[model samples]
Target: MSTRNSLRSAFLQLKRRSSTNTGGVWSDFSKRPTTLKINNAPIRQTLFSEGNSEEGPASLTNGDERLAYHSPIAIDETFQMAYRILEKEANSKYQIVDRLEKSLKNAASQEETIEIKDRIDKNLIEAEIENPEVLYNAEFADSKLLDKSQPVYRHLLKEKWENYDLLVTMQRLEQLHVIPDTLPTLVPKADVKVKFTHNTEDQFSKWVTPGSLLPAFAVSEPPTVYIQEFDRVEGSNNLYTVLLVNPDTPDLATNSFTTTLHYGLKNVMLNNVDNSIDVSKLLKVGPRITFKEYTPLTPEKNAPAQRACLWVFRQSKEIGDISEASENFDIREFAATHGLTPIGAHIWRQKFDRSVPGVRQMYGLGEGRVYEKVRSMDPLNL
Candidate 1:
């Protein structure tokens, strides 16, 4: 098989795993390849080891110095109950009728079309508790994981779920329990030399902060034939990019990399963020990249740095080359919904070349960077 084909098959394998895993990876993740850690030693000795391996000292003690960072772990469940009740109340018939009547009066389209859609919206809101019917039933959940023939969920919730009382309740829920999620902290400093940059320290500063998205891509949609698949999910865009920066660096340092990475960038696809719980338009990551650390910077200038280094150029030929390989991805049905013809492999290789960022010299403390920005647990989600 062609090199591209092999890579494409591997991409499909990963998506299958992610879909099968119910736990949504916490808001962030690593860019480094996976490796195992040995944890066979006693917890107390392993955690408190000073490296000298002497018997326990009589008076020496360490607790807070162990680099422990904590966040709320005990989640409050009351908020879930309260939100569900309020959501039901807000979706009542009288409320739906009032909103639909107002929108019908305000629409700009042909009066009949507007009236039809408005009535459908109202009726959907009023009759949502009923089970799915024939070809015209409105879906009413915050999900698009259903078949394309199924409709995306939307209703009175979009217009009415905006009250701040919901926010107030959610914030209060964070206090209900001490749910602490801990992660490794960035190295205080790196003593290393990065060869790729004019000034390695300047580049290393940016890799410490984290942001939105992950590295992913889906196959371009296939050409629609007779009886094209009808998308039950709507309003999802077909392109997306993931930023793998570290947050520990000063904000200004990363500004350049951000612009440099995305400026006038072409061919990269964005994921559909509108209604699905799944990762949309994700590009499959191949084994073309790796991370390398610089040794040290000391004396007149003491410094530590972690740079994202690319070791391989040609990724595996799983099933084919870039485009042909991508055929194994499940991006076509959604594309067909919008009336566009599906794209093929040759175009995908072009996409692969254009979209990936220049990480030849990314530096940072890696994953410990993006700490402050992740959103807290939604009481409703709990």
Candidate 2:
């Protein structure tokens, strides 16, 4: 279909169900709607003040009669602001405890029940935020294409659900028209394009070509490889393995692969020497891969090292987001090599939620609660 018509149809289809102000079609595709089952969030009232708006209408015969009676306890302003930030990202446990403690007063009166309740609520929000349903995973959402109840499919109807970074299920389905029993393109080629970028100052590209599978086989994700071909010995095929990780940022799921890694495979070299290996038939790319994930405090284990693992992709493109990389993106070929089976929206929905890594090192018990609280209170701020 023509880009304009497909976009128009997507928008019209979405417009039929949702009301949006701008960028309506994209919103409908990527939105994640939170289920509102529990509805009691305490909004602490500030201490009484002169000309307080809490006093209600000016025409009231009595001041107390105009407003509902509030308790005599003074609400902690700093603690309350701290609570606001805490609840915002309740899903992030690591940050939650820190945010909550920031609001705690060194001393408080014993009679303050509300203040105590606030602390308890911190625990409650943490539990709710930990659920995988609160997060949107690409794999899970994709498996649920047929299930109309899923949000990624249903979100295509919401007016405010505009920012979808991943490709739509329908577009992926249409991609099947071109290939058989193969990995479907996750996005339209015209949308995202990837490319190679050189450090202007260095002249040498930072992209790594792998030396051997020993580095890639080290873990499930790719590692860094730091061998350049131009300055290598003769009879060496210049290639390297590239890897990437999720980065563990809230609401961000990242996937990456390398350009090529068949380095020095053309002829057997009895000895290693220092010379430029020409890369005449291979494509070189700079890629970031996730290696070992470490504990938040201890960076030794999983902190990825640059120039680490190098793996091959079905096809290589320059560095960029979806729009720039989509042109050379080869999701179909990558899936076949990576052991990813073709799944529908219904299946992917559950998978996406299940694999969300609810309590990763970056977001632990305390940080999770703060994330949820902050998100619940001010989603736009995220």
Candidate 3:
């Protein structure tokens, strides 16, 4: 049937169902007389008990009165603001979907097409419910699509739940160029695993999420890390360099991306250069040469949490010793000059807020000093 005819039929069916349902509820309405009238003697609504206003002009003085109140100006302003935000969001969503759809329509292969389609579907779902709470509450809120490791997504949830410190840290990671702009992007299968290990503890970990204990517990002891790629360099001597930096230092006021180096290690040789060795257990053989020793992360009081970013770069054979490098280390320039390609990176956060006084004391920052530090770090005064 035609669309118009189908709608008409549907409406007729609904009307019939409504009339017949619930013991013929609509039958009483249908049987009511269409014409009805009353004597024009001024109908008296029981304003207060059973009083007639016509008895005396002032007889109904004790009646309850209600005045309709509304703030049309404020309501209109709020509605306009809401509309603008929603409009901007909707426009952004449609643009992304359109762009993705176009790309998929022109996809080269079936495999690529399927991948693109999946991404499109995921985008649509994300746009439909931008709020994390709605998605979290949904029955079909697929865990596969929800990447809590993503800085933005993680921060949204943290902000919703009032995890203030980690939220700032996550945002700082993005701002400092530690994480790529296109992140939450899939890592290629060929990429090697560069993992972190604790010196005091035997357990190893991959991702250092904000919710994890790495933020607080890691400050006690330095963590050991080894890259898998250097071990696999067959019949050739390869050295690696590691550097860690905290961009949120002096957290005194505003977050300045200018960094303070936490640790640096250089001239790292993988196991014995001669014998065949397992790449996975390279740290078990012997400790590599340490250029700069690990310094514990110390964030100032009343500041945003600090992100301790560790970058591992493959040392070029042409470059000599870099042991005397200063704390104001430049990772990008050092990489370029020495032909050092960054193999992997890791990040963990730390904070010295009022909630954790013991942590502040551990760093030798006194209570008076902490208050002074708070004054210095206030962004508003700056």
Candidate 4:
């Protein structure tokens, strides 16, 4: 197979696995190659691309819609509750209505979108006889995860679960009880040389603090990451795992978060500090690979700032035979269960607020594109 074809096939395999395990969002993702030329060099595009006409309001079509249909059933139940609450509050109902309309218009299929619109419109026109809480009881009758008292849970519904990826990450962290008070520092100050070289600038900051958003253009492609542990003992076989995740996939329908495991590497032998690990090259190795490759960063407009996180873990020998953990690999669970502790980490924020000329070339989005800013949850919220 051609190189491009081979890569696409690999992604197809992952897409099937993701759909089967994680609600099947990837199964419906577009197969077209979305490419862009930056400084006369081409870069890969985001995983999902909703093929909406370029002339229409960008708000109507951005990010993934499959997440809406195949999301956890609880999300749909929550949306129903939000709909009922916003219905009673006449003062702030229009804003919610407009958002809902946009989502309905952008549904994955015409039939599905129409069905949703009809059901919700019917509810809106009917008399407010039933309490929204009553619907919650009926819909989530068997669910223990729902808690009305916790605004955070309610907030997830309000935001349409856009922070789904981050929330899941936080859930794992909370389970392990890591980072008791403050968010852990993303990148530790070490002798490592890390830089994301762009034509406009090069990012070599000593550290990136949590809760800050970096422009998507600044991180269009994977950065050059190198680590050197001078304190390593002689004749030691030290294997490390590097993980990159985006927990802020803006679901256009519900405006909630869904996560994408952008990149992950396991059993990478870090023999010496002088040698560096090139992430892009490592992706070429196959079969055992968890995710396909380092997908370029393109945070959708009108979505929350994406938390682009990188975590490093030192593998322990006692935690043997981790080859079985592939589909929907949960980093938090893997770390806790396998006794792997994160040694170094870093985070970059990306939002689709500004026009990235580079990305425009890839998606065929013309100039003067403006992405409405939306409120995203803090990573430390968990």
Per-model tally of clashing residue pairs? 54, 101, 2, 13
Candidate number of the best TM-score: 3
Q: What digit string (tens of lDDT, one per residue) describes model 2 on residues 152-211?
A: 223332212224422342333343222222223322211111112322323223322121
Q: Write the per-residue lDDT of candidate 3 for residues 108-161, one digit (tens) a residue.
A: 997797677667655544544443223332222332243432323332333443
Local accuracy of candidate 1 as per-residue lDDT tens digits, 1-382:
4875565445434434333212211111252111111122333222222222232221235544333322122111232234345435534643565666677667777756556565654454343333211111222222223232212223322222224322332232232210010111111110111121122354322221111121211111111011111221122323221111121122233231110111111122222223111122122321221111121111011111211211101111111112211112222222223232321100000111211222211322122222234333332222
| TM-score quality measure for candidate 1 | 0.21
TM-score of 2: 0.17
Model 4 alpha-carbon miss at residue 327, Å: 10
Q: With candidate 3 superimposed using the best TM-score fit, by how many Å does residue 11's alpha carbon deviate from the native?
A: 62
Q: What C-alpha lDDT do the candidate models reach, one value each?
A: 0.24, 0.27, 0.46, 0.45
Best first by TM-score, ranked = 3, 4, 1, 2
Ranking by lDDT: 3, 4, 2, 1
Give residue 309's lDDT in candidate 2 (0 to 100).
15
Candidate scoring better on lDDT of 3 and 4: 3
Which lDDT tens digits does candidate 4 get at residues 1-382? 4985565445445444432212121121242111101111111111111222122223223345432222232343354445445444532333444566778867998678667665544333232213233233324333223332222223333233323433443453344333331234222312233346543553433233333456656556566666544333223337666777665555444545555666666766654422356555455543343333555557555544566666767667534344533324466665677666566554556767564556756656455334455454433242
**Models, CA RMSD each:** 26.1, 28.1, 21.2, 28.4
Off by over 4 Å in 1: 1-115, 132-144, 147-382
Better of 2 and 3 by TM-score: 3
